[model samples]
Target chain A: MRHPYADLVAHAAHLLAAAGLDGDKPTVVAERLVRADAMGHTTHGLALLPAYLRDIGSGAMTRSGEPAIVVDRPAAVVWDGRRLPGVWLTARAVDLAVARARDYGTCTVVIRRSHHIAALAAYLTAATDAGMMVVVASSDPAAAHVAPYGGKRALFTPDPVAIGIPTEGDPILIDISASITTAGLAARLTTAGRPLPGVWALDGEGRPTDAADVLSTDPRGSLLPIGGIDHGHKGYGLALWIEALTQGLSGWGRADGEAGWGGAVFVQVFDPELFAGGPAFRRQTEWLAENCRANPPIDPEKPVRLPGSKAAAGVARAQAEGLELFPGILEALVPWAERLGVAALDGRA
Target chain B: MRHPYADLVAHAAHLLAAAGLDGDKPTVVAERLVRADAMGHTTHGLALLPAYLRDIGSGAMTRSGEPAIVVDRPAAVVWDGRRLPGVWLTARAVDLAVARARDYGTCTVVIRRSHHIAALAAYLTAATDAGMMVVVASSDPAAAHVAPYGGKRALFTPDPVAIGIPTEGDPILIDISASITTAGLAARLTTAGRPLPGVWALDGEGRPTDAADVLSTDPRGSLLPIGGIDHGHKGYGLALWIEALTQGLSGWGRADGEAGWGGAVFVQVFDPELFAGGPAFRRQTEWLAENCRANPPIDPEKPVRLPGSKAAAGVARAQAEGLELFPGILEALVPWAERLGVAALDGRA
Candidate 1:
């Protein structure tokens, strides 16, 4: 059912607050999560709420904590998230990066011990909106589905990445995971008793399997890199690259250290206006988009869609007609809302 | 047969110098090209000598030209390569970035109107060797391969990116092109009458085709991305991101402009010693490499190899034996060398 974007965000915030995330933390986390859902990225959306709540309850995640600044230079800063929510810390870090970029034309911020940042695109959204370009990367110790390139066993997380560039017409955003298929999506398909598309997964023996049950306790399966089973070296390369930028460079969660998910987060923001005039930068990007779109479509009826164009449209639609939530997601959050004494979602209670 | 790496580099330097790129320019260009070949990247190796010679002969490339610094700030700098050899200008820009990074802990350098930078890895190697982590992305004008994610028509170049992270054991180096296979590889195979590997290209109809001939002058085919036809959208997104970072951000080579093989380069450098203590960063990265390596390799005998490790080993081997040159590649460069009044590579006049 469709729910108002604000309402969904409010519900998420309330739930987090009731679960011990007080202050602006809830708002920060909620906004990022709901924004993902609004942009139709259900995998990174409300589905993670349960796991986050569990982490909070287990004391694995810290609430009401301040990320310590370890290094603060003119063009760079490194922070220790202190196990705080990644959404809040990453957003703050991106803001810091943008601010520094404004001053120096470019800046890089690295954070260690950060939690799962729900949607990286949200952090970059602010920067791109401000006429800046940003590249954000994060790594986690506990990998789920992604196997190392040319290997059978899971050795890396999906290790998602996002890049945003502002344009006068529409900002171009490219958000992607190194994995061929997301574990969350696989889990969802498994929950719904559906088969996966193509050979996006593998069983423990390095054989192809479409069964989602492979990821359960027995752990008989893993997700393939973006190139799937045959040529995943590229995805493996990408995941390794992200790991270096975030974990390797930041001196945070090394791939071999700590079994659980935790790592360094790196965000770099570049203000085009610092090097080139803002108008010119925007115009160039717009021209690029137009040229790509104006080219005759492979299918005459279908025009090229810029990277963030569809997401932006989804967001606009979500804001106009409440967010569209899966019924299962709404049901799952009901009991949690009662326990926290937070307001239930608008369409359910 | 393998030859001494120094021997190969000297040969390339002699050739480029004979082509009018003398002094530091030939050394810089030759070093990057020969190193790439020694590292097993034939695409960016001596194979490019013919094109470099052709461009120089046509006056499309300058042997000796001063790259004008267009913008210089504390955190960022932009250079006008003036259509000079990409190696010289990019190396200079990398040095500029390293200097700025040394001071501010982070810095970026962008170069416009430069020629092909043999390999992205070489530039990162320079930064990482200086004890800084680096990320570099570069793009060429449109090449007829790898359609943007959705549509069939090829619109973007197979943008290349390289990232380096200083590890306690060995710096991690990852260099990748946005496309699944490079045009050079495809062209080489097509010329050799070799069957393409497993649907690496798509016909004009967007259907999978393994025929290398599909990439012929008729241009009836385009290359697939690392993820194949469907997953190329991710590759497309990445290329667009690189474009924004290097070209758009620098206000050079706007997308719609007349297309040619020009490079827009972006280099980012960060000093680990500046953020966390140098010792701490080393310890952290060492721990990470250990964890990754120790994680019971999928194949025990083939243990996990760090990114730069293999390349370093290759360099060592090449230094002992010299850079390996394919017969076809040698044949292609003979004419160019002779035209430049240089002795042929066989060592006889």
Candidate 2:
């Protein structure tokens, strides 16, 4: 059954606050997570709360902490995440970056010691909505779940990067992990009793395996890079650069370092007005978007789509008909959420 | 056959000049092209001489012109390529970007009315060698060859972006097209009597086709994006953003526009000293690279290699035993080289 976005947000916020998180951070995290669900990325939505709670309970990720400025400049800022929730820190970073870009035309934020960022599009929506172009990348220092192109042992963690463009329609977003699949998806599939596509993950012997549970658990099977075997170098190269841009620039530890878990993040924001008027940037993008949509489809019955169109559509549909959640989320959250006295998501508590 | 880098550059220079190119610009083009060959991307190397001549002959690309500043700022610059060789314009842009980045800590350059840039790595090598990180993206204004994820008709080119990280060893370069394969590769494979892997392209009728020649010719079959069907949304998103950054930001036409041949480019250079010291950045990257190299191999017989390590090795080998020419290149250039009175590539006329 579908639930209102606001109710979902409030429900998530209540659970987060009750889990020992302090200040106004819970609201921000809730909004980001609900937005993911709203956009049909339920893997990054409420499913993440359990992990966040676990991290906070173990003191691996602090529930009540703020990022510290490591370096501050008009064009660049470096933030140490201080083990805070990435949503909280990233929201603040986007604000700071947009503010800085207004004056400097471009600004970059390198975040060290950051926690899991969930979905990159959640952070980017704010910046793109503010009429700035955003590019962000993140890599976990320790949570290695992906092997290098030909390597058996995991040295990468999908190393995602995302870019957003403010447009006339919904903001255009390109978010991708360097690996063919993400650890989160593996976990979700495992929970749902599904086998992975045959080429996606490697087992203990570095042979291809379809066991989602084996792929998701600790000492898990490793994810293949985006191109699988033949073109893995492309994805591997992207992952390496993301790692460098995040860790190297932030002075964070390498993936193999002892300090594992919450790692590094890199963000760069540019004011389109720096190069052209914002309107013109929007116009060109709109024109391109129009053409992308108008392009004839291979299946004549199906229309072409611009990037982010589906996610944007998902948001609208979720608003109208409520979110079609990935199964098992509410089931998973219900048990822990009871401790917080947060009862039914239907607001019957 | 082995020829000195200097001789190869000179041979390329002579051919370009003989095609009615004026001034010393041919040397710049030659250097970039030869660098591509040295790095083993021979498709972008001497093999492109015939196209250059044809472009100049048709006045689609001018043999001699200079990039004029469309906008100038300490932190950003926009150039009008004036149909000059993209090699010349890109080299100039790189110099200006590196110079400005030294002062501003970060700098961006956008190029309009540009020609084929050959290889992004060539322009990147200089900045990377100079101890700076560079990000570059380019898209053709009208040379559409890739289909949007759901579309049959072409709405995007390869629309590649490349990043370079200066390191203690080989600069880590990650260059990729938004599509699985590039137009150049399609052309090469067509000439080589090869069939594309089944999923690579869509025929004129929008049916999947394996014939390389069919994909490369006019009314060309459209290329699938990097992710194939299952996740082409990711690649289409990347292409869309590259289009926005390069064409939208540069005030250039979208891929659907009439202005064709070559299009626009975006380049940003960052001095690591902006936030952290360059030495620290290099050290961290070196550490990461070493671990990437030492990662346990799936096939223990073949050790893992870091991105760009193979290309760097190729360059070193080329320096020793010469750049491997695509089998047909020197033969293709022989008649033109004789026309330009430039002979003796490998001491053979």
Candidate 3:
């Protein structure tokens, strides 16, 4: 079944408000979560609402409060999210950074203790639409599912980073995790008794394996970093850098003890008008995008495309037609909708 | 044979000065190149001197000139390097960024038309020693050796990125290329009739192969991105981000056509005192480093170590004893030394 995008966002917002989110938090969180689905990141979309609701019910997530300012400067700012909705906090942070970047030419905001920010890609368009470039990264110090380059024990999370570049047409959005595969996909594959397509995980004995179940074994396996076995040192270095950008800069992380299911985020915005003129920046970016698209592809049937091209197409399709929610996503939300006394979404094309 | 570090620097500086560089340019370039050797980055170290000398002889590199200031703002600055020595340009840029960052919280400097900067890691310690975090990335618009994720033809360079994070002990220095291996290593292996240890290249037909000779074939195979075949999109995205940071921000790139053995560079520095207090920042970073080092290794005999630990040790060893020049490096420089009428270095411990 297909549901209108606006209707789905409204329904989600209503449920979040009834569940405990106050002021504009419900709307911001709902919009960003749905935006992830619109961008084809189903795993990070409405699927996470259940866990967020659980956190709220258990008082793990705080409601009705603004993030406390830890440090503020002309080009750098640090915020203590206080377990607030990460979607709302990140959205607010991007706005603040974009505004400050105009004056300072660049601005960075680091947030600690933010609840899991839904897909990093979901927050990129806000900055790109304003004709600016932005970088976003996140790490969860409380979670450990990835190991160092040659270590057998898990010591880090996926540690994802995203960059948004403005061009003449659609913005180029780059989002990637330092790990080869994400823990969410690993868990889902394990539940279905399926093996990964590639050797993306290492067993407890540090041997490469294709079985997702290795992650659930007695001694426990770990996800391989982006470079996998032969060159994982590169990925390991990248993960550590992301950790420093997020947790180290924020002054709170694994060293300070776990703070439940939350994240530490790094957001920086750059204004091209301040560096090289906007026209010059666009000229170079657009030219590169064109050349990349023209490059001959390995498979002739699948032409070369820019990083964010597909996501842009997905957003257009979802808006024109209707959003096709992933299987089980809408069904899982029904119970929450009923419990919160919110009207259920109509599944009509 | 080993040579005293000071003697090697002086010899290299004399050669550079005789070739064409003026004032402190020769000394800055010589020190940075030798520093790469001390850190075990032999490929980027003194081995590059022969080619640099040839560039000077051919008038490809500017003899003496000041970089034109394209734009100057509080937090962002751009420079037209005018084909100056990249080592000197990058070192000067880092120093300028560090100074500005002290007042602005953060500062970014982008340079276009710089000759190849020696090694990214060589420029990191300058910021780390000052208790600041720094990021450096570079791309060569005139050359392409690594292919895009799904494409068969090369559209980008190795696109190396480096980060320096200060801790209580040695700073965590991360230096990595977006590609699995660099073109210089590929060429050297091919000349020696050796195959790559892994399938790190794609032939003209986009078939994965370990033969370094494929890179020299008629159709020309290209180096694979860091993630290799199944997961190269991540690396491809990172490479594009680097291009944006270096060339796009500087308003110059591949779009301007080949400019002959030059690079576009990006350097940014951040002060911990302006973001989170310096003590709090160091506390988190130090704790994370210790925990990482303590991670159990896959091979019990080889324990886990941070990214720059080996480099730090290499520097200590070289300083204590003497520098070991890679085989043929000194021999290759002999011709340039005689042509420039500079004194040859003595190989004495």
Candidate 4:
């Protein structure tokens, strides 16, 4: 069952507000959450709402908290997320960084103490829309899921990184998780009681296992790195490096870091026109896109997809025919919408 | 046979000078070349000398050509490598980028018309030494060898990307070829009469063939992307992204664009302390390294190696026990050394 994108967002926002988040914060948070669903990244979308609501309700996440700019230099800024929702804070930080990049040529933002950042691709889209190039990385506490290459225990989060470049028509956005298979995907499989693919994970005994009990493997059952079974070392290396760049540098999440979800996030944005002449940069980026798309595909029939091309196309389709929303998401948001007095979601439950 | 790193460099410099390279340029060019050899990256090392010398002699590359800063912005710079030796220009460009990063907190440098860059790692090491994070990419013309993933025809050079981050002991350097293997490696194996590793490449008909003759296959052989045999699309994606960032943005080489031996390169440098407090950033990076290294190995005997740890360890070993030179490499530099008036190898013919 599917719902319209707006109703899903309205429901989620209503719940967030009912849970104590005030003003533009819920609106900001809901927009990103729904955008993730619209872009088809359900993992970072409303699937996280229940946990988010619980965190806020239990005071693990403070709804009223505002990110503070701790350090503001000409070329960089460090923001204490104040335990705010990562979606809102990260989006704000990236926006500020892009504005600074336009003035300073390049700018970086270090965000500390933020909670579950929804799809990183959202912030990159924001930066690229402003005609900036951006590289962003996120780190979380030892979800204890991914093992370093050649290592059996979970040592790092399958840290996610996103790089976005502005081009004509649609910018190139590359969002990659250092882990071979995303935890969310694995969790979905586990929930569905389906065996994981061979590339998904390993057992405690250092053997390949398809068991859907992903978290049960815990310190023993670990996620494989991106290059899969043999080359996971590369992925492990990349994840650890991202960890260093984001959470490590933010000065938070160090103590008890091996446990749960707290870490740093880093976002850097560049104005391409700062290096290449603006027109040239745009023309060249477009040319590169066309070159790849126009090149004879290895299969000749299949089109070579540029990183963000599909997402942009999806966005277009959503705008035209409404974004799809899952049934679980809608069912979870009904009570909150009633509490927030936001009106029922489009004549559905 | 092992030779002093300095001795090999001198031979390379001398040879280039004899081939009409500017006298002052040889040392930088040679340093980049031999550094690759010293680091055990033989593919990008002295093996490239013959081709480079040929380019210089043929007027495709020039000595005494100074790169001009074409664009200067707070966070970016564009330089015409002026057909100068790639190593010399890239070194200067990256150094300039580091300086800019120090001043601006972040900086990007794009160089066009640069000749063959000996080793991507060399440029990354420079940024790390400056306590900055770096991403570097370079694209070359179709050398008629390394293939795009899944293709029979060689469409581009095995364009490579290297990323580095600053750490306490040694910076983390992760350099990888877009191609699973290099043409030179294939050539070396053929000379040694070794059977090709399974799935490393495809023959003229696009069938999986490891005859090493994949390099000589008519219609030209193509190197598989990084995933080795299956799902090389990931590697293909990475390679295409790097090309877009560097050569694509710089308008240096398009797969079908202007024909030239020279290519474009892009380097980005970021000062971590700029975004994260200096002390916090250092602690974060250190913690990241510790967390990764603390994990127990699956093989028990084989420990996890961080990205640059091997190269740093290799450097230490070379410093103590002297660098190892391949027999073939040592034999090839004699004529060049004689031309430059440098001392020739004692054991070489």
Candidate 5:
């Protein structure tokens, strides 16, 4: 059954509020978490609510006041999240960055000690709508689930880089992890007795293995970098840089040797009006969108889909006809809703 | 026999000079070209001199004076390269960006109508060494060699992105293209009758194929984005944003529809000191470098390598011993050197 997006947000906020999130933080959390699902990234969407609640319950990530402004320059900022939920901390950071971008044509904001900010595409999409392009990169020093390109051991987090650009038709939000597929996907494939698309993971012996061979016992396989073997070096390079920007710039430790909890992030916001006139920038963006859409198609059934097109469509559909939760996602949230005494999801959850 | 790097630069400079390029521009071109080879990017190095000479000779990419500063903001700049060699234009742009970065914490310089900047690693390496971080991305609005992800025809450049980070030890430089394999490599694989690694390319029918089956006729297959088939969405997204920044921001056209012969470039330089203290930034970079090096290798023979480690080794070795050109590089250059009346490479070629 489909539920209005607003109901999901209110329910999520209610649960978060009952779980000790005070002030407007619960709304921030609910909104971003719901948008993840609305934007078609169900992996980072409400499915992660259990983990967030666990983190909150265990005091692993605590709600906090405004982000601590460690370093504040006209064009740069370092926001210590004070161990806050990433959704709340990043929401504050984005506003600061957008404000700074207005003053300086560009702004670089580094965040530390924040939990997973959820889907970066959803986070950066706002900047796109604000007529700015943003590049957001994050690394969880705590979660080292991806192996380096050729090396087998998991020494890196599946670092993600997201870029959001404003277009007339739809804002382009390209958010992708450095890994070809996620560790979770690899696990699913292992259980399903299916091979991954390619050499997208390595077994415990540090040898390449088909996904079907990733047994539950002995050594578990690690996710491969984007491009897998052929050009994994590119993804590996992207991962390294993402780490440098997020971890290095934020002064958070690397994910390799010792990783604590929380995340290190780097956000770069740029005002197109600074370089090209806003109108020209908009017009050129339209030109690019047109040319990309006009690209010759290999499959008659599928045109060259620009980044965020599908997600945008999903969001538009949800806004008009209501959003549908994954088959079991709503049901899975029933317990949390019951435990928190929040009103149960009306759509059979 | 192999000549020293300086001689190679000098010979290259002489050739460019012979091709009507005078003043410091030729030397700038020569140095960057030679450095590309020294850094182990032979494809973009002197091996590309033939193409460069042809472009200059054809007047498609002309040698010009310093880039014209069309829009200059404290933290942003729009440079009209006036169809100059990318090396010179970018060299000047980097300096201006560096200068502006010093004043504004961060600076983004956009360039229009520039030739190939060769390897961005070398260009941004200077910034890294100077205690700043820089992200460089370029798209050739005129030449589209890569198909959009899932699309058959070429609609995008093999758009390249590079990031450089400063550290106390070896700096980090990550330079990568958006394609899994280059068109040139695909062609070579086709000619050699060797199957390409994984499903790295497409066949003439726009279907995925191994390298050996690339029948390069009517519908010559285009190179896939970095993630190939499974996750090419990531690479496509990267290509789009890179285009928005380089082509869109610079007000240059996209690579599709109309063809041109130059680059639209975006270079963002940020001082790490603005966020983390310079000393802390340096220490953290060193920490990251050490952690990356210490990462357990999947193979005993190959350790995890940071982005620039291999290139650094190559540069160090080339400095210790004379730089050696690739097997056919010197031979290939001999004709151009001979045509320009420059002393031919003293090597066997």
Candidate 6:
């Protein structure tokens, strides 16, 4: 069933408010979740609301509080998210960095202990809309699903990074993980008894395999890094840097001990006006985007597209024609709506 | 034949000085080039000196001049390198950024129109030795050898990024490019009448192939991004970000028309002490490094090593013994050495 974007957000926000989130946290979380769905990141979208509500019930995610400022420099900041909702915490951090960047040209905010931030791309538009470039990266130190380059045992998470660049037209939103495939997709494929599209995972014995179930086996197989078996060292290096930027700069991570369902984040915003004139920056990016789009594709029927072009188109369609929740997502949230005594999405006015 | 490290640097510097580089520029270029060779980056090492001499002879590289400061802020800067030696210019930029990062927590310097920066890793230790984390990336707007994700025609250079993270032991130095392999390797393989190790490139029709000569074909094939065909969008995104950070930030790029064999570079330095405190940062990174090393390797005979471990060992061995240039590198420079009336490596003291 398709639901209006506004209705879904409102319903989700109401359920979240009833569950415990205070102030504007419910609205912020709801909007970001819905936005992720609109952008076609089905796994990280509204499907996560049930888990978030459960976290709230168990007091895993802090309901109402401002992140404790760990360090505040003119151009840099460290924030203790205090187990707050990652969606809200990350959004707030981007805003803070954007505002501060005006004065300092560039500003970076590192957050420790932020509860599972959903869909990094959802938070990028806030910066790009303001004609700024932003970079966001996150890692869950308590969870390890990826092995280092040559090692078999898991030692790191996917370590995703996103960047937002504003051109003359729609902004370019880049969201990528250090690994080839994410844990969520792997689990989904395993549950469906489907093999991966390629030999993207390694077996327990360190041989390449297409079996998603390997991830669940004893001495579990691990997801391959972005460059796969041949050039995985590049991905390994990228993962380490993400770890340092998020966990190291935040001053808390796996070395400190396991934290439940939480992650460390790094957010940076740069004002092009402060480096080169904004016009010149946009002019160069616009040219590149145009040329990239014009580049001849191998398949004549399929044209080359920029990173965010498809997502942007999806968002426009969702906004105009309403959104169709992936099967089981809305149904799963219906029970949460009932338990919280909030109007179900279907019952919305 | 192996030559003493100091003797190689001195001989290279003499050749560069005779070729036209003035003051400390020759020594800076020579040291960085030799350091790359010591670190096992043979392609980017002394093998590039002959090209540098040729660029100098053609007046493509400015021998001596101060860069024009385009923008100078407390935390951000832009420099017009005016075709200056990128090796020296980048080294100076790192020093400037490191110095400014002390007062600003983080500092970034973008250089436009710089001659080819030899090796990104060669410029990392200066910042890491000072207990700072540094990021360096470069893109030559004049060159295009790597194609966009879905496109067959080339739209980008290799677009390399390097990061240096300080730990209690050796710093983790990561140097990677957005492409699966570089044009240098492709060209070398083509010249040797050899195929690539894997299908790391695409044919003109966008079919994956291992033939390095495809790159020299009429409708030239292009190098694949790091993730290759299956997940090249990630690498394409990385390449775009590197372009934005280096060329977009510098306000001079492909859109401004190609100006010979030069590049735009981005350098950033961050002080851990300014955020979570240096001790805490190191504690976390050190733990990660150790655990990664101990993780069971796929092969018992080969243990998991950090990114820079092998390079560090190579440098140590070179210092203790002598540096060995690639077989053709010394011979390639002999003609230039003789023409410039400089003492050759074989006659070094």
Candidate 2 residues B1-349, lDDT tens each?
6777778888888888878888978898888888888877778777787788678878988776578787787776778887888877888888888888888778889998898888887778879988998888888886888888888788788898888888888888878878888888888878778887656788887777667765556666788777677667767877887888888778776733557478689988988887766876887788878878888888989998876667778777777776657688878888777766765476632
Best by DockQ: 6
Error of 2 at B116 (Å): 1.1
- Residue pairs that clash (backbone atoms under 3 angstroms), model 5: B142-B260, B196-B211
Per-residue accuracy of model 4 over A1-349 as CA lDDT, tens digit each = 3456566676778778888897688888887887777777877888778778878877777688578877788776788887788888888888888888887767778888887787887777888888877888887764557877777777677788888877776888877767766778788788788987655677886666667675675445887776667455557656766776676456665544544354468888777666564566667667656656665555766666777667777666665667766546666666655655666667532
What are the clashing pairs of model 3?
none
Candidate 6 per-residue lDDT, tens place, A1-349, comes to 6788889899999988999999999999999999999998888989899999999999999999899999999899999999999999999999999999988889999999999998999999999999999999999988988899998988888999999999999999999999998888888889889999988889998888899887789878899988889899999999999999999899999899866999999999999989997888998899899999999988999899999888888888878988988887898987787899987666432
Candidate 1 stretches greater than 4 Å from native: A217-219, A259-263, A298-302, B142-144, B217-219, B254-256, B291-304, B345-349
**Interface RMSD, every prediction, one decimal place:** 2.5, 2.0, 1.0, 2.9, 1.9, 0.8
Q: Write the per-residue lDDT of candidate 6 for residues B160-261, one digit (tens) a residue.
A: 999999999999999999998888889888988999998899998889999998778977899999989888998999999999999999999989987699
Ranking by DockQ: 6, 3, 5, 2, 1, 4
TM-score list, all predictions: 0.94, 0.94, 0.99, 0.91, 0.93, 0.99
Q: Candidate 2, which segments miss by more than 4 Å at Cα? A: A216-220, A255-260, A320-324, A335-337, A341-344, A347-349, B18-23, B63-65, B216-219, B338-349
Our tally of clashes for model 4 stands at 4
Q: Please report, as a value between 0 and 1, the fraction of native contacts recovered by candidate 2.
A: 0.63
Off by over 4 Å in 5: A184-198, A210-220, A255-260, B184-198, B212-216, B255-259, B345-349
Which runs in model 3 stand beyond 4 Å of their true positions? none
Tens digits of per-residue lDDT, candidate 1, B1-349, equal: 6566676677778888887875699888888888887777887888888888778777788777588888888877888777899877888888888888788887888888788877778777788788787888887654456666556666666778888777665777888777877777888888788977778877777678787766664546677767876566777777778777777866776554645566888887878778775666667666656655664455657676666677878877777766667677778877776777777665431
| lDDT (Cα, tens digit) per residue for candidate 3, span B1-349 | 7777888889899999999999899999998888899898898999999999889888898889899999999889999999899999999999999999899889999999898887999999999999999999999999888888899999899999999999998999999989999888888789889999899999878899998876678798899999999899989999999999998889998888966999999999999888887787888889879888888889889898898888888888877787898888899998888888887777566
Residue A96 error for model 6, in Å?
Answer: 0.8
Per-candidate count of clashing residue pairs (backbone under 3 Å): 13, 0, 0, 4, 2, 0
Every prediction's TM-score for the first chain? 0.93, 0.92, 0.98, 0.92, 0.93, 0.98
lDDT of 5 by residue, A198-288 (tens): 7777788877766645435366557778877677888888887887788777776552344446788888888887777666676777877
lDDT of 4 by residue, B1-349 (tens): 5666666676778787878877578888888878777777887788889788878877888777688878777676778887889888888878888898787667778888787777888778888877788877887743545544545556556777778877676777887656666777788888888866656787766666677767765656577766655556556656666666676456555534555576688888777766665566666667666766787777878887777787777666765666777667766766656655667665531
